[model samples]
Target: MPQFELANWLPQVAWLILTFGVMYLVVRAALPKVEAVKLSRAKVISDDLGHADTAKTNAQSVEAAFQAALVAARTTATKVTGDTKTTAAADAAARLKEIDAALAAKADAAQATLAKSQAKSLKSLEAVATDVTGDMVERLTGRRPAADAAASAVAQASA
Candidate 1:
């Protein structure tokens, strides 16, 4: 009933108009700043995303270059390893050949010394056999065997 009273409506209408006008002016003054802040935030986010994309692309390119360098280094290392192995093998073969030749010479000298020692031992053995045979014959038959005959007897027994 109070809302519908026609006599109180003029003051209510004036108050409503004043409040609406103040609210409109306040909103109108602040709205452009709010919109500007929102647009600026969006632009900053877009710029950051663009920069991230560019950084990612640069990182990819750097990775690609690093991979290429690594491949090249590996190839070079393989080649160097192969070359070193080949050189070492060749050197080892040469040294082995030299050592074999030296060992063969030393073996030949050792064989020559062994042959001379054997010959000396054989001559001394023959002399000792002749003396022992002469003494044995003298003890058994009261006569000593001749040196040449004792030597021949020893040679026959040995054969």
Candidate 2:
């Protein structure tokens, strides 16, 4: 009932106006600071994002450089390995050739010794055979053969 009276309407209207004005002024005063804080936060976030992008780019570049270095190292290692293998093969070939030469020389010396021994044994066998033949002939015929004749006959028979 008091709210519906005409006498209370003006005071209510005046209070309403006062309250709305204070609220408007307070909101207006705080709006710029809020906007400034929002903008500062946005700028900070944008700057952080830019720094992250720069870091990402730097990481990519560093990774690429590392890959390049790795490739170069692998290439150098392959070349060195190939060179070492070639050197080892060459050294082995040279050593093998020297060993083969020595073996051949040893084989030739053995062959010469074998030939000399064979010649000496043949001469000894020839002398023994001649003596045996002369003794056999003397025993069978009761006459001894001459040494030169027996030697000549043995030589002719062998030839």
Candidate 3:
């Protein structure tokens, strides 16, 4: 081939400049809008994540409040049961004391009645024994005791 000339090289250089200018315009002007759209999408994603965190915190607070209320209810139930037990024990004690007092009174009255019956039986038995002894003495000795002597002997024997 002959040596390259400026006339042929001019068209190639002009084509290169035109292609580069178009590429530069596309990159500088259109790429910024794409980048701005991407930045806006990233901001929306960050805001969503913040909202999710707030919702999780609210759920945890509700759970804690429910647990506290359950604990308080259990404590109140236990206290009521304890109070009922104490009242039942007090009632039982009062009944036992009343029964003991009644039994003691009955036993004292029975003892008083027994003592009075014993004294009356002893007096009757002494009179019967005196009459039998006097009859036997008169049959054996063929003599009767005087009234005053018999009275004195009966008194001494009874004592």
Q: Output the number of the TM-score-best candidate.
A: 2
TM-score of each: 0.67, 0.71, 0.55
List per-candidate RMSD values in Å: 4.1, 3.5, 6.4
Number of clashes recorded per candidate:
0, 0, 0
Ranked by TM-score, top first: 2, 1, 3
In angstroms, the error of model 2 at 88 is 1.1
Worst 10-residue lDDT window for candidate 1 reads 122-131
Q: Write the per-residue lDDT of candidate 3 for residues 1-159, one digit (tens) a residue.
A: 333776778888899899999999989999989999999999899889889989989999999999998999999999999999899999898888888888888888888887777777776655655565566667887777664565567778878
Regions more than 4 Å wrong, model 1: 1-43
| Candidate 2 per-residue C-alpha lDDT over 51-90 given as tens digits, one digit per residue, 9 for 90 to 100 | 9999999999999999999999999999999999999999
lDDT values, one for every candidate: 0.94, 0.96, 0.81
Of 1 and 2, the candidate ahead on lDDT is 2
TM-score of 2: 0.71
